[model samples]
Target: MKNYLIALLAVVTFGLASCGGGDDKAADNQEATQAVEQKADEAQQQTQEADNQANDNANQEENQEAANDQAAAGGKDGKTLFMENGCVACHKETEKSVGPSLKEITAKYGEDKAKLIEFMKGNAEAIVDPAQFATMKPNLEITKKMNDADLGALADYIMSIK
Candidate 1:
């Protein structure tokens, strides 16, 4: 009977020790979970801030484009006014058309700003694509009938075709 009691006591002691060790492991797991959650939260916050900055930059770019368009409509540069008024309708960029293409025109003038502006003022003959000049001749009559300010704007736009 004494041997039986000793064996029972040993079993109970071992069980208690095992339970104590398991408690410490549970605490460690809880702490590790808390750390992971905290790091995830920080990452989420950083991502949100980056997204907000991108949105702000996009908005600023859009605003800038709008401002440039408005300036193109009213600038004293003349070419900007012509582009704003849709003078590109009859003119093409490289090939021939109802109006001479800008590429050929620029090729003939070779970037002479003063001469181009003067030519746009209806003073000079068409340099590169005279074949289309006849078609545009009636347009000159119509443009001449326009107000001086409007005509200047159109001429400026013509000079900018390049």
Candidate 2:
């Protein structure tokens, strides 16, 4: 009977020790899981911040483009006006296209700013490429409405190009 009691006590002690050890292991696992969740949360926050920064950069670019377009409309520079007025579509800086290149126009009319502005205003006839006058005449509708300053700037910009 004494031996039986000793055996039962040994079994109970061993079982209690194992249960305590299991509790420690479960606590360790819980801590590890919490750490993993924290890291994942941080990574998600960083990703969200990066996305917001990218969106802000895009908005800044859009705002800058809008400002540039506005400047091209009434700004002192003629290059902007020329670019915004669709002059680049038909005329290139150096190469000839549907219309005479800006260089060619500059070479022919650079000596006379008044004449160039008058031509842009549609008050003067085509002198460089009269064969394409019909094509150029239609484009003048936009040019004729420009103020004198913009025309002068455009003429100056065309002449300034090499």
Q: Pick the candidate with the highest TM-score.
A: 2
Q: Candidate 2: global Cα-lDDT?
A: 0.84
lDDT of 2 at 49: 100
Q: What is candidate 1's lDDT per residue for 41-60, written digit by digit as tens?
A: 99999999999999878855
Clashes of 1: 2
The digit string of per-residue lDDT tens for model 2 on 41-152 reads 9999999999999987896576456446547775656777888888889999889998888889988885797999999999998999998898888889999998877787
State the weakest 10-residue window (summed lDDT) of model 2: 62-71
Off by over 4 Å in 1: 75-162
Residue 150, model 2, lDDT: 78
Model 1 pairs whose backbones collide: 78-156, 79-156
